[model samples]
Target: MLAIGMDLGGTAVKAVVIDHYGNVLKTMSKPLGQHATSIDEWNWKGVVKSVAADLMEEFKGRITAMGMSAPGICNEENTAIYSMPGRFYGLEKFIWTEYLDHETWILNDAHSALMAEAQFGAAKGYKHAILLTLGTGVGGGIIIDGKLLQGRNMMAGHLGHITVDADNPELDIFKIPGSIEDHIGNATIEKRTYNRYEATHELEAAYRAGDPVATYVWLSSVRKLSIAMCSLINALSPEVFVLGGGIAQAGDSLMKPLAAFMEIHEWRPRGEGVPVVVAHHGEHAGAIGAAAFAIRQSTK
Candidate 1:
């Protein structure tokens, strides 16, 4: 069977057509024009509708099952976004099923990324795993005992908001002080570096060139990330931790140091270590995962 998966992002809307075997038959992305800074100008509802319509038409309306990944809490029914504040106006309680004229399954983007990795990417065969998307901020999901843990509110996999430091007073959006997101998320780069660097990529470039300050900042972030992972290892004991997102594009610059730190911090009882690998699906993970998720749901 074939299905459609769509990821609604801040800047663009990505969609894919895929079969049950996880082969992507077609992929397309639509820019959401310029991002609106305020709620009044947040124009996304119409664009998403158009994108969905266009995709359906292109496939001659044969593709029926659809799934969406968005940046918010998805309802238990997976019909609409449950709650999302400060962006994507009209997304809250906006029913994709009603708008798209199809029964659409919706999931949080981070959770969707995990689903993609768990379904066909890094953690394909693993029954238990963790996925972390390290970009503008840290977002994560958990798969436990061969199932995605979508807590009571469908909010279980929020790994980024966990506290890493008690002494630090800085709070993230969730009001958690010194959380992992504050330490390693790209959103915190300027604040963490005292405005020395504006983005993680620039810091990584400087770190590569042997710049002392950049090296310090970059490694510090990775060290905190490793620390968080070690704590998670003790708590969840996932078989593997898959890393994704834009900052993860640093390749060995991020992985090698992270490995070193994990070796130092992670406690292994039998000397067995959990592997931390990069995500296989890359940028299209959300969309692909959404499609895969829809296909799975359809089969069920």
Candidate 2:
């Protein structure tokens, strides 16, 4: 009936307590003190301990299950992170179950974000759905017939890595050029601009003002994203797409262009369009999904 979730971000650890009905009863976040650099297992465990202890201290016995929203690929049992960029160093060697009393189910942040959107935010009734969070990187997940789809390795949902171009300069974690994340990731934008804007807002502002350079960069990113979406359209044909993360905060600035580009590229035989919507959940989404996922998994 109750569960706790943790969103283990590169910079912060977000945790939440939620009921079976998808209501967030309580939440909190603790700073992990770094970005992109992995903290050692001992310190990482301490941070997790602090987050779990703080939430459990308040909700105490009210919690029923626990889960984690991690940054990258997870193992079959979801107990250890097998591989990731900026992974928690030594996490594969360290074990949480040894120190914690609760069993946990861990999912990639992208997958967890998708679950959160599906369970508590957007795409509620859609049987087939996809989520793309455009932030420091592009993250995505897919749902089919009302179930989270996972492959044999439980790492099948790396939608960001799907190739959009063959000759582009940008590259993904696998060193593939022109991947969706390589083109649209926040880091990619930064690399293109050469640190001219400290925040995505400045670049967005430039684009809004019709600055040619910014417009080109932004629209190009959108086009590549559209290509990726169209591929998904032709292959999986998901009913809806939920876009979240920081850059998606640009709202209509993103959706307007994204919609237009997708229209031209996607296969619309019957003229039916897949609605692209913004994520409604705030920062608590990943944490909420982790908790909800744990609860859902326990029932099975």
Highest TM-score: give the candidate number: 1
Off by over 4 Å in 2: 35-42
lDDT of 1 by residue, 1-300 (tens): 778899999899998888878888888888887767654676677777887788788887588689999998988988888989987877899888887888889989999999999998999999999988999989999999988889998988889999889778777899899999989888888987879999999999999999999999999999999999999989999999999999888998999999999899999998988999899997789998888888888878
TM-score of 1: 0.96
* Model 2: ten consecutive residues of lowest lDDT: 33-42
Off by more than 4 A, model 1: 37-42
- Each candidate's number of clashing pairs is 0, 0
Native-structure RMSD, model 2: 2.1
Provide the global lDDT of candidate 2 against the true structure: 0.82
Error of 1 at 115 (Å): 0.8
Q: Model 2: clashing residue pairs?
A: none
Estimate TM-scores for all models: 0.96, 0.93
